[model samples]
Target: MSFEHEKQVCNLFHNSMEIIGRRWTGAILVSLMDGPKRFNEFHNMIPEISSRLLTERLKEIEDYGLVTRTVLSDRPIQVIYALTEKGAELQPILQLIGNWAARWDSKPNIEENTTEKVLNI
Candidate 1:
């Protein structure tokens, strides 16, 4: 390949990584793959993540136009977060990654892992 093409590919990969490479971002995205969820739901699904960090990552993901935030009308105003068409498009990519990880895992029984159940890998 030409040097210019190689440079463009590298830049594209780096730029995409800048968004997904952040801690907890991938998990957040993967969680939403199933369906829309409230803020508290995200915390519950990803227990290891602190509220502050999840909030930050959610805002960043929303800013990237990957996720949408909706405020619902109810007695206590509810806010729901869901993947945009752009974000939903990442499902196949994430599933592919999950499959790759399963193959490389040293553990003999990946089926028993909670992440496999969560990610539906």
Candidate 2:
């Protein structure tokens, strides 16, 4: 492939990573794979995430057109978040990553090994 084509591919990959590689973004997307969920539901699904961070991440993804935020008009108002088609397309990719991690991440820490090698060198 031409250098220009490789550069374009690298740029696209970087942009894609910037979106899904953010902390908690993948988990948030994975949680919504089931269906639309209310704010509290997200909190329950990802208990370690702070309410503040969750709200921020939701707004970020919503802005990126990856998610839709719907406000329900009930006695007590509720907001639901769901993945858009663009976001839903990531399901298979995310699943494949999950599978790969499950298979390899359980092994000895590659980072530690690399660090040791570097120190010895």
Q: What is the C-alpha lDDT profile of model 2 across 54-116, one tens digit per residue?
A: 999999999988999999999699999999999999888887776556556756654544322
lDDT at residue 17 of model 1 (Cα atoms): 84
Q: Pick the candidate with the highest lDDT.
A: 1
Best by TM-score: 1
Candidate 1's C-alpha lDDT?
A: 0.89
> In model 2, which regions exceed 4 Å deviation?
107-121
Model 1 — which ten-residue stretch has the worst lDDT?
A: 109-118
lDDT of 1 by residue, 1-121 (tens): 9999999999999988899879999999999988999999988889999989998999999999999999999969999999999999988888777777767788876675545776875
Q: Which lDDT value does model 2 have at 82?
A: 97
TM-score attained by model 1: 0.85
Lowest summed lDDT across 10 adjacent residues in model 2 is found at: 112-121
The 0-to-1 C-alpha lDDT of every candidate, in the order given, reads: 0.89, 0.84
